[model samples]
Target: AQLFFISNGLSVGFASIQTLTDKSTGLKKGIKGDLTTLRPTIMTAVPLILDRIQNAIESTINKSRFARIFFAIFFSQKKFWSYYGLDTPLINLIFCRKFKAALGGRVKIIACGGAPLSPETHQFIRNCFDLKLLQGYGLTETSASATIMSLDDTSVGFVGQPLDGIQIKLIDWEEGNYKVTDKPNPRGEIVIGGHNVTNGYYKNETLTKESYKEENGVKWFLTGDIGEMFPNGSLKIIDRKKDIIKLSTGEYISLAKIEAELKKCPFIANVCVYGDSSKEYVIAFIIPNASHLKSLADKLSKSGLSFKELCNDSEITAGVLQSIRQIAKHSKLHKVEIPNKIKLCSEEWLPENNLVTSALKLRRKNIQDFYQKDIHLMYGNEHKP
Candidate 1:
C-alpha cells in the first residue's frame, strides 16, 4: 500500500536526512517523509519505514497494542496511554489497492536497503501480507547500489550475492588471526571493487587511501562491515567493525548483535542497543511494532497482564517487557546485553525531525546529541525498565 524507509544510526548514503532537506521547505525540523501517493507494490526502502507502517497499523486496529508499542518506543517515564490513538482507517485505505489480475496482488514485492532489514520484519511482511519482500545490501561508496536479493534466491540470512560486475572478497587487516578471518564461513571485512566504487573522496586523499584499500593490484573499497560468506555463496553481515563496544571486562560486544536479537521479537520496530562496560550496562531505544504489539497485548491481557496495571509510573503491558527478555534468551544473548531500562520513544525519527538520513541511514551522533539529557538521566537513575 505504502512504503517507508529509514536509517538514523549509520551513514549509508552520506549526509544525514537533516542536512540534505530541500531549502525551500524552510523548516529546521528536517525531512518530513517520503510517502508516495501511488499505490506501491515493489516498495524498497531502509528499515525505518517498516517501523512506521507497524505503528500506524497498530494505532488504528488495536489501542492497547498501540499503547504497548509506543511504550517500548518512547521508553519514557510511564508515557504510554498519553500517546495519540490508532489509525486503522489509514491502513485499510492503504492496503485496499486496486489491481488487475495481471498484477497478482495489491503489492507484489517489497525491497529494503540502506541498512539491514530485521528478519522479523521481513518474515512478517511476507507471511502476514503475503507479499514477496526482498532485502538489498550496498552503500553510496558503491554508487549507492550493489548486491540485491531477488525472488529466485531470497535466503533467510544472506544479503544475496553481488550484482553484475561487482567483485567481492574478504580480506584480513590483521595477519595474526588470518586463519580466523580466512575461514570460508567466518567473519571478515566486506571489500567491493567495481565500476561503481568511487575513486576517492573530494580533497580527502587520506580517507581515500583508508577507504580504497588495495593488495597485489586488486583495488577494493572497504565497507567497514564484518560479514561471513556463506557456504552457499550467500553473504551474511556479522557486525560493524566500527560499532563494537568494549566492556571493561575486555569482552567486545557488537551493537548489531543486540539489535539483531531484539528485531527477532515480533513486536519490536526500531532497536538501537548501546553502552560500554565502562559502566558495564546496556540500554536500548525501542520503537515497538504497534500492530503486532496490540495482538500480543490482547493475548497477554487474557493472562492477566494489563498495560495499565503493569506499572504505576507508565502503562505498558508486562508482555512488552517479558517479550524482550524472552528474545534475549532465545537469541542466546548476554543477560547484561538485554536492555533492562528502556524508554518508549514513539515519535518515528524522521528526516524532518532531524533524526534520519536521506539514503535511509541513522545519524547516531545526531540522535545521541538530541537525547543526551534523557539518556544521561536514564543511566544515572537506578531504575531499570
Candidate 2:
C-alpha cells in the first residue's frame, strides 16, 4: 500500500536545503547541503512536490476513494497554485516525511520558493504536520532570497510583498528597445535594486551592464525571470527569459519550468527538456528517483496493474499527458508552456555522470549538450506514439 502520513514540518522545514547553494554565488553564501543547527526561521522549496502529486493521480489512483480525494486538490488551491505559475503546490509535502524528525522538533515557518507552492502542499502540511509553508521569490543576483511571505500573516503562494529597502520595476524590453524607462508591473524581466543584490558577475562587465540599469532612482539588477507586480505590492515569479524556447511550430515554450515540473515527479531525479522551433515537439530525458520508482512498482502491483505492461502501454503515455495537462491547468500556464514528450528511464542523472550538480540539481544545458543526439532521436519518428 502507498502509505501517507503527517510528519513534523520543521524536521525538514529547514533540514534539507540542498537547492539553496549556487556555484557562481560565491563560496561564503553558497550552501553545500542542508543546515543542521543554523535552522532558518523560513525555508524555501520548489514546485516539484506539487508536480509529483499531480502525476500520482494518473499513475496509481486505482479507482479507490483516494482517487477522488487526491484529484480534488487540483481545484482547491487555485489562487495558491497560480502563485508560482505551477498550481499544484499542495502536493509538494506528500512525500516530504523525513523532514518531520530533523527540525530539532521545532520550526517557525516553511517558505516554498523556486516555483509556486500548491495550495494542497501548503494547507496540507499546515494542518497535518503543523508546519506553515509560505511561498516567496528571489534570484541569485539578489543573493538567493529577496522577498518572503510574512509568517505571522501569510496566504498560500502569495510570495507576499518585497523586503525592506529592496526595489523592483518593469521595463520595455522587447528586442528593439534597449534604452527604455520603467513601467509599474508589466510582464517583462523582473528588475531588482538593493544592497543584497550582487554587484556584477565576476569579470563579466558587459553581461553585467546589459543586466544592470538605473531605474526609479536606484541601480537595478535584471533577473531574466518574467513576473508581475500586484496592485497590493506583492511579487510573483512566472517564468524565465532564458527559458523562452521557440518550438518548431513557432510556439514559444518554457522548457526550464517544464523540466522543473518533471523533476518534481517523485520518480524523477534528473530531467532535461529539449526542443527548438526546428523541432515538432519538445522531448525530455528523465532519471527516476529510485525510491519513487520502487514505490511505482509497488503501487502498480497492489492495484493489479502490470508495471512492465503499463510501462510500454500507450495508455501509460496518454496518462503522462493527462497528468501534465492537469498540472498545466492547475498552474494556469499558457498552451505553449506545456511539454508533450518525455523519455523515462530507471537510471539516475548522477553527479558522476555530469548530469547533476554535486548538490544533485539537474544541469539542463549540460545534459542537452552531452545527449544532444539522443534527445533528437527521442523526438524523432521511430518512437511509438
Candidate 3:
C-alpha cells in the first residue's frame, strides 16, 4: 500500500505551531483541496474530521431534491440491505460511487483515532463511502496507536485488540466503582506496557511516578482511560478515569460518552456534557447543526428567526431535546446518564475560541465555564427536557 503524509508535523517533532497557516499559495492547495485532489488510498484522521466529511456528503445529497427522494425511497430496499451484508460490491458500484467520487474516488480505508466516533456516524460513513473505517486506540504516552483494527475486522463499538509486543491489563478503579471482578463486561483502568510506550513524562518526576508503576518486574503506564474488555478480547473505552464524576444521587456518569451520544442527534452539531458531584442530573451545552435547524424552522414556519432566537425558541428547543432523548434511548444510556437540562448556543466551537483541542475534542472545563450563565438559567427553571 502506498502512503502519503499530510500534517502540521506534530507527530514528527515540529513543535513550532506558529509557522502553520491555512493560506494556499502557488500550486499547492489547502487541506480541503489536498484531500479532494491528491486522491490518497488510505487516510488517517481523528473522528471529528470524519464527521465533517460525512456532513459535507449529507449536505450535498440534501441539495439535490431528486437525490434526496431517491435515497429515502431506496434506503429501505433489499438492495441497500445487501450493502450491509456480503453483497456490498453491487451497492458501491451503484449508489456509493457518487460518494466515493466526492473523496477523490480513491480512498479505500480511513483510520480513525484520537476520540470515539459515534456509531451512527461510523455506519453512515461506511455506507456512504463503501469503505472500511478502521478504528485505532492509543494516546501520546503509548507512542501513537497501541492497537489498530485489521482490514477484515468489521466490528463496531470497540477499538481493536492490543498490537503485537504490547501487553495490556485492566486494574479495578475503586473511585469509579469499576471492578474487573464484575460480571458480563468487566471494566477498569487500562494499563499498558510495551516497547512503544513512553518511559515517563519529560522532566516531571512527580507526574512520572504517579502515572507509571511497576507491577512485579514489568513497568506499566496507567492510561487514566477507563475501558471495558469484551468477551471477544476487544476493548471499548468508556471514559477517562479522572473525568468520571459521581452525581449527587451517587451515580457515576461518563461525560464523554454522553456527549458522543448527544452528538448523534441530527440537530446538534457539537455538545459538551457538564456535571459536578453536587448535581443530580447532567446539563448539556449544545451547538445546533445549522442546516438541520433550518430544516426544522422551515417546517415550523419560523425560518426568519435569528440564531439566538431560534436557539431559545421553545418549539425548537423541545424538538432538539426530544431528538437527543431518542438518541440516548437508542444508545441504551441510563436516565442518569442523559442530560436532563440542555442549553443551546449559537456560536460554533472553534480552536480560536479555545473550546476544542486541535484533534477537535471538547475542552470540557473551558466549555462549562464559558456557558456558566446559560447553565445557571436552565437550572433556575425546572429545565424540563
**Worst 10-residue stretch by lDDT in candidate 2?**
1-10
lDDT of 2 by residue, 1-385 (tens): 0121124433332323233322112235534424334545444445553343334433454446775575455334533543445523344355223333343234456556665555555654553333566777777778766677775544554677888888777665574222224355455677778777877889998998998776556768888776666677776666677766666676677776676555444455456677656665676666554344445555445335444444444544445555556766676666666666665554445567787765455677787777666665666754332
Ranking by lDDT: 3, 1, 2
TM per candidate: 0.67, 0.64, 0.82
Cα-based lDDT for every prediction:
0.60, 0.56, 0.76
Error of 2 at 279 (Å): 1.6
Q: Give the least accurate 10-residue stretch of model 1, judged by summed lDDT.
A: 77-86
Best by lDDT: 3
Candidate 1 vs 3: which has more lDDT:
3
RMSD (CA, Å), each prediction: 11.5, 10.0, 5.5
Give the better candidate number (1 or 2) by TM-score. Answer: 1
**lDDT of candidate 1 over 1-385, digit per residue (tens):** 1112334332122222223222212234543322222334455556665644444444454557765564344322212221232223333333323211112244567677777666655643443344556777887788866677767554555588788988887777452232234654666788898777877789998999889976676667998887777776678776787777776666667777787678766667676765746667777776666556546655545435433333222436356667789988988998777876766566666667776676556667677777676677768864232
